[model samples]
Target: MITMKEIARRANVSSATVSRVLNNSGYVSDDVRKRIMKIIEETGYIPSEHAKALRTKQSNVIGVILPKLSTETSSRLVNGISEELAKHGYQILLANTNLDPEKEIENLKLLKSKQVDGIILLATNRGQELVSEIQKLSIPFVATGQVIEGVPSVINNNFQAAKDITSHLIEKGHQKIAFIGVDEADWEVGHRRKEGYLAALKENQLRIVDEWIQKGIFSIESGYTSMKKILESGNERPTAVVCVTDRLAIGAMEYLGEIGLSIPNDIALTGMGASDLSKYVVPRLTTIDLLSETTGAEAAKTLLEIIKEGNTSDKKVIDYRLIIRDSI
Candidate 1:
């Protein structure tokens, strides 16, 4: 392993000069800086990141927390985050929470202990415990997919997206619509979406039946069960169904198929997230595109800015679009 001294000796410069050149500090002349850089590059002299952190108080590493790694949404968000962070010479230390809130809190502390420059959270919930933990952290962080008061975040207009999709269904002459949602603990996907669906129905003067609403976890099996219940319990079946996520919608579709019901002909359907599976499924699910990758990229950029320039308590809202497909 070549040391800075060796590189200095090879370049006929003092160790301090080489340090200045490597750190880009204390301004060495351009010609000398270039010579030292060339020698260091040619000799493959790698600087100690630990020493660098000790000197500059920056690890150049960012911690990322995701709800799950298997989902297409999470994967796309990670891709966006990785691309943005790499441009700044920062790497991600990933922590998977597996949809557990306690693990989310634990991972935050663990990442802080590792002295990462900052954290980016793909949050599923905004519980007080998580909010309190976030407030206590010294490092800056930005949340994606959900909003937390007093915390910077990058989020979609989930309420508007839901309302738009519901209104779209209404425009297609769907007066009797059903909803498949998740636990309200997930404010963005569950509560806000339900609120939007209700708002659209009320605005359009459509009657909402209590039996038309069903709750499911973020899973295909849960969606299937919820749909089954809705179909069995309701006296008057809904003509269309709007699901909070593509996964849920897919499950509902499977149940409909098992019952020999044709889509749009018998029942129309819509889903959110625009997951990759949405386009490939038979009839190609009509859904909302939350611009998830853009949301992740923006969250990373926001966190980096906060880490570099101090937190501005900024909140960014990304836009969404509806993808019309054969399902609806």
Candidate 2:
């Protein structure tokens, strides 16, 4: 295997300088960086992770713990985290907890045991306890997509975003607005979005009807099933429906299409998540952009700053927006 020593010799720089460039630690002059890159490319040099860890007391690895990676929402967040970490010569160790508290805690221990320098968590309610545990370990970690008390977080304003989307429907002459989200007992995202929905209606002097609110998993199948249940009940079909996530919105749309319901004419549909898939669907989804990419990037940056500054007392909050489309 091509080694850093050979690259250093070829680049006419010290091995330490070559190592610094490769590891993204310490400073290398522009000339030295260019020469090292050239030598690395020509020699196909690859640094040994073990050796780098010995030098920096860092594994060059970050743990990314998400509820699940099966959905596009988590996938996009991971993409953003990976992109930022790569720029800093860091590798991501992904852990899918399947929204299980035990699994998430287990993964946290494993990542710490492996000596990862930092972690980014897309957390649920159970995260508050896990984060409290992680804090005691003095490990650098950031929560993305959801917030927990007493920990730094990178979150979109889910409450405000949902409120804005709901208010828009109300302004468009829709008196009865339905909300579909996951069980609030599990995910914080669902809870906050639901809060926003209720807040908007309450502020507008509209009755908050329990019959109009639905909860299930944040999946297309769940959305479809829940929406079907709502339709079957014959309990005042809502003029508009707001979903907690884009996947749910898409699923609800599919059901609406099957039942010969015209979107925005018979019933309007909208959801959270600015995922690309939302654009391709017919009567393209009207949704909110969570700025998930920025959230991920900022999480990495904040974690790195915490690691460098040796401080964990700060938190970061990102904003969200409503992206109107043909759906509403």
Candidate 3:
């Protein structure tokens, strides 16, 4: 637990000067700044958040509120945020909201009290209330995944991506395709993906069966249970299933395997995000590549622009690709 005082002693600068260098405050020569940074690094000095908040009146910390850190998507997004923010000399204060709005709101309030410079929200659903609160506080923030009105966000075209995936399945001769996803009326991703699924079906003139469409929480367990229920209902299983995410695809495939079913031969599965694991699955998953890294890079760049320029910009929409692999 090396303190700033130790770093100051090692750098032969006053504690105040060390504090200034750490907070990017008053003029410190570039050479001196470099030396101080080196000393801080060598000393493993942990700066006081309270002191930082007081001197800079900004934490120089970015709040990263994610749905679930365990998921591949959230982890990749966090990695991207880390990579991009590191370049700007900012650190992240991560919070797992567990897809709970109450938790998300609580985390936002805590971050505000801590005086974080800005927040990069990987929020789910409509964040209108949270965004409104941020606006009232005059705090800088940006969202990822789902966008709300008046909030700048970084996300892929979910509707288009889903539409493309569904169309791909249709082109693959999957007329009786099933869509398994989150609840459409609530979750933004669920709604957008469902829109895409419907679009493809309507465009191809394929019948959309109510039984073939299922929605649940975004989890492997939820996917497994929903799929199992779908199977037990004795309704003829479709030739293919379009999962809203790779996690769901993985879970559905696992259950399908256990029931003595084989992929592509019995059923085909398509995932939304082209997660790394998707490539290594028994039958490589055909999916939409969300370009999560590129999205993260762009989000970080946007926030920096807001911080430096003191202005909010339009939402950034990253492009996605339909990746055709063995699963289709």
Instruction: Choose the strongest candidate by lDDT.
Output: 1
Misplaced by over 4 Å in model 3 are 1-52, 232-235
Worst 10 residues of 1 by lDDT: 307-316
Clashing pairs in 3: none
lDDT of 1 at 118: 93
Query: CA lDDT of 211 in candidate 2?
Result: 66
TM-score of 1: 0.97
lDDT of 3 by residue, 193-290 (tens): 88889999999999888887888777788778777877776657788899998888888999999999889889888988888889998899999989
Query: Which lDDT values do the candidates have, in the order given?
Result: 0.92, 0.84, 0.84
Q: Model 1: clashing residue pairs?
A: none
lDDT of 1 by residue, 74-94 (tens): 988988898999999999999
Error of 3 at 173 (Å): 2.0
Clashing pairs in 2: none
